[model samples]
Each structure stands twice: as structure tokens, then as C-alpha cells.
Target: MHILILGAAGMVGRKLLARLAQDGQLGGTAVTRLTLHDVVAPEAPPVRVPVSLSASDFSAPGEAERLVAGRPDVIFHLAAIVSGEAEADFDKGYRINLDGTRQLFDAVRAIGEGYRPRLVFTSSIAVFGAPMPEPIGDEYLTAPLTSYGTQKAIGELLLSDYTRRGIFDGVGIRLPTICVRPGKPNKAASGFFSGIIREPLAGQEAVLPVSDSVRHWHASPRAAVGFLLHAATIDGARLGDRRNLTMPGVAVTVAEQIEALRRIAGDAVVARIRREPDPTIERIVAGWPRAFDARRATELGFTAEPDFETIIRAHIEDELGGRIAA
Candidate 1:
């Protein structure tokens, strides 16, 4: 089978690529050809499959059209601006997140009759707004607070409509904040969640942007990839009119995270975290959902981290070669 991964150089994109490359398959489907696209071209996959790399902006006039010309068997759309960047730059956020998504949808719609490709989109829990009912369910209303959330919520609607029209089989996985992201921090307010754990494990100092009592939803990078794979393989007939589902995740407080750190690496690493709360971050995070029921995703067989300790260990194994030595 053929597969195309957009934003192929970003952190999640790279992890997905590495997972596919190492496994040499997705959901037991052998990938005969893989296409990687990003603003800057991505490196060739380490696998021996026929790999194509290209640099293409999703917002450019003809870019989306060109990217989908091959009509690969499956397409994983993982490109988007982070929450902080999107909130700070409204125009750039809409241009890429909204307009770019529309352009891709239009391109797929333009495909000839009987052309149906499996489209897997990576959305986020930001689709929900403040004053949220705790443990937001899959049926919860999507009243986004920020422009980034609005764009994603809008993307979900478009995907459902397009699939309804028989244009393509689409699945939108509303992802949780990925914990222990294996890279330098980005502009996302949730970056601190990963930063505090990832950096400290690397024997580096990291910042804590909110109070230790702050709690939120979380998933591991491995679980994120698993969601994509499941979305690609699952029977879309089971989705019916509701094409999007809130993903299962572990809910834990920042204090619990520090405790896990102390358990894993002792007091020295835990002390490396400095608490200097930023109200901007706190405000942004306050509106985000703390937990999700995710019953639909669970019923559909998507898995989640069992606990914070499991999440931290997955990060160590996947990102740090299974060693927390400082």
C-alpha cells in the first residue's frame, strides 16, 4: 500500500515516520511507497521502501492539489500551528490551519468518481472550550475558545460533511496533549508538560509554567501513532455520521508528574524543575479540558496510557534509549 504523511519533519511527524520505518508496516499493511512532505523537505526514510520527499506549503495556490495527485491509499494529515503560535498570530493560524485544510479537502473532493482514500486527520482536544463539563465526552459540544481550536473544530465538521458526501472515508482523532514530547519545546502552552519531564530526564533544567495542582489530559507519542494506525485500519462504516471521537488519555496533575520524576530520577532531577508560573500560560491552559470520557474511541479499540508512570517510562524507552541516568 502507498501512504502520504504531511508535515513529515515535525516532532509527531518524525515519530510517526520512525515508527512506520522501523515496523515496515501500518496495521499489517506493507507500505510499498511512502511520500513525505513539509514546508522544508524531510529526510528519506531509513526503510528500503520507495520513498519520495518534497517541500510544499499546504496553503500555496496549487500545493495541496499537487500533493494528493498520486491519490495514495491512505493520507495522514498532521500539519498545524501550535496553540500559542496560533493564538498569537491569528492570520497565520487561519491561513494554515483552516484555509490549508479546506484546500486539501477541496483537492480530494475534486478527485474523480469512485475515488475514495482513507484520510486520517490529527485534531486536538482544544476543540472544546472553557466552562467545560469535566470528563468531556465524545458527544460534548465543540465550542472552541481559541483560534487554533476553532480551526480544528471546523476541520472536523468539514471532514464529516465530505465523508457524508461519499468523497472519501475520513477519521478525525481528537488527540490529547502528548506527554514527554521528545524534542526541544515549541510555542504550545502544553509544551511545558513535556519540557519539565523530557529536559529533566536529559539532566537539563526545565521550567514549570503553571501551579503543580494544574491537571490536564495526556497521551504518549506511541499512543498517538497507534491512534493514526487504528484510524487508517478501522472500518469507517462503524463511524456512521459521527466521524470524530475524543481520544482516550490519562489525566494527572503537575504535582503527580513531579512525584513521578522523583520516583524515577530522585530529588536531584526533580529539583531541576523551577517554578515560575506565567499567567498567560495559566489562562490558556485553564480553558483546556482536564479529562475525556472517550468512550467511543475506547469502544473502537484505541488504547491509552495506564498512568503517569507508564507515560514517563514510554518516553524514556522511545526517546532516551530506555535510560533515565543523569
Candidate 2:
């Protein structure tokens, strides 16, 4: 199978590449080639298959066309600006998230002649807004509060319409905020969720930007990749008209997270998390959905960590090599 990964340079993108390279196959099929693209050229993964890397603004005229010209068997669309960045820059958010997504879908449709490939889009739970139910269900309305959520919600709608038209098989997974994200922080409003655990485990003081009472959904990066793989290989017809599904995750408050850190990593690591609220981040997070039922995703074989402690341990095992600050 031939695979193409957009946003191949980002943290999740890089992890996906490492996983594919390590496994040497995707969905039980041998990978024959890889086409990696991003705004900046993505580093070529050390895979046995032939690999091509491109760096360009895909939203620019004809750029998306060039990407789909090869008719890769599966396309993983992981590209987009983060929540904080998207909210702060309205024009940029629309251009990259909304316009860019539309362009890619149209480009694939233009490839007519029975050239329909599986498209796995990485959406976010931010697609749902505040004043929401405790465990948001598959039937819940997607009334997003932030520009990033709005863009992802629109993407979900487009994916459904295009799939209904037999243009391509698409599955949109609405991911919760990924905890214990490895690497320096990006501009996402949810950055603190990972920062509080990641920095402290690495022996650095980290800031807690929100209240302890604030609760939210979370999954480890490993689980996120598993969702992508399942989406790529699953029987799309089972999804019916609802091509988008909210992924499962552990739901907990800030206090629960800190307690989890204290449980596994000791009190000192937890102590490193200093409480210093940021009004801007708090406002943005307040609009996001807290927990999700995710019944359909679980029934369809998608899974995540059962609790926040598992999330922290997974990060330590995967990124920290079973080592932590003493």
C-alpha cells in the first residue's frame, strides 16, 4: 500500500512516521512507498520503502493537486494550526484550516475515474462547545466556540458530504487534548495539560494555567496514533452517514491529574507544578467539552487509557525510557 502523510513534520506526525517505519506495514499491508509533506520539508523516515518529501504551502493554488496526483492509497490529514494560534490569528486559521481542507477534498474529487482513497482526518474535541452535556454523545450538536473548533467542525461536515457522494472514504476522529505530549510546547491552549506533567517529570518547574476544578478529556499520544491506524483500516461502511466519531479518553480535573502525578512520580514532581492562572487560556478552555461517551468509537474497536495515571505512565515508558528525575 502507498501512504501519504500531511503535517509529517509535527510531533504527532513524526511519531506516526516512527511507528510506520518500525512496524514496516500499515493495516497488515506492506507499505510500498511514502509521500511526506508539510510547510517545511519533513525529514525522511528510515523506511525500506521508497520515500518522497515535499515542503510547500498546500493551501496555495495547485499545491493540493500535486499531493493527490499520485493517488496514494491512504491519506492522513494531520495538518492545521493549533487552538491558541488559530484563535489569535483569525485570517491564518481560516486560510490553513478551512480553505486548506476544502482544497484537499476538492483535489481528491477531481481525481475521478474510481480513484477513491481512505482519508483519515485528525479532528479535535474542541469541535464541541461549552454549556455541553457531561459525557457528550455521538448525537450531540457540534457548536464550537473557538475558531479552531469551528474549522474542525466544518471539516467534519465536509468529510461526511464528500463520503456520501462516493468521492472518497473518510473518517474524522475528534481527539481529546493529548496529555504528556513529548517535546517543547506549541501554541495550543491545552498545552498546560501536558506541560504540568512533562516538565515536572523532566525536572523542570511547570505552570498550571487553569483552576483545579476544571475538567477535560485526555489521551496519550500512543492512543491517538492507534486511533489513526484503526480509522485507516476499519470498514468505512459501518460508519454509515456519520463518518465522524468522538474518540474515547480519560476525563479528569486538574486536581486529579496532579494527584496522579504525585501517585506515580512522587510528591516532589507534583510540587514542581506551580499554580499561576492565565486568564486567556482559562477562557479558551472553558469553551471546550469536558467528557465524552464515545460509545460508537469504542464499539468500533477504538480504545484509550482508562485513567489519567495510565496516561502518565505511558508517557514515561514511551518517551522517558522508564527513567524519571530522581
Q: Which candidate is the best by lDDT?
A: 2
Q: List CA RMSD, all candidates.
A: 1.1, 0.8
lDDT per residue (tens digit) for residues 1-326 in model 2: 99999999988899888999999888899999999999998999888889999999889999999999999999999999999999999999999999999999999999996899999999999999978988898889999999999999999999999999999999999998998899999999999999999999999999999999999999999999899999999998789889999999999999999999999999988889889989999999889899999999999999999999999999999999999997
Worst window of 10 by summed lDDT in candidate 1 = 317-326
After superposition on all CA atoms, how large is the RMSD of candidate 1? Answer: 1.1
- Candidate lDDT scores, in order, read 0.90, 0.94
Query: Candidate 1 overall Cα lDDT vs. reference?
Result: 0.90
Tens-digit lDDT string for candidate 1 (1-326):
88999989988888889888988887788888998998988988788889989997788999888888988889999989889999999999999999999999889888778778999998999999988888887778999998899999999999999999888899999999999798778899799999999998998989998999998999999899888888999998888889998999999999998898889879988988989989999999988889889998999999988899999999988888988757
Who wins the TM-score comparison? 2
TM-scores across all candidates? 0.97, 0.99
Clashing pairs in 2: none
TM-score of 2: 0.99
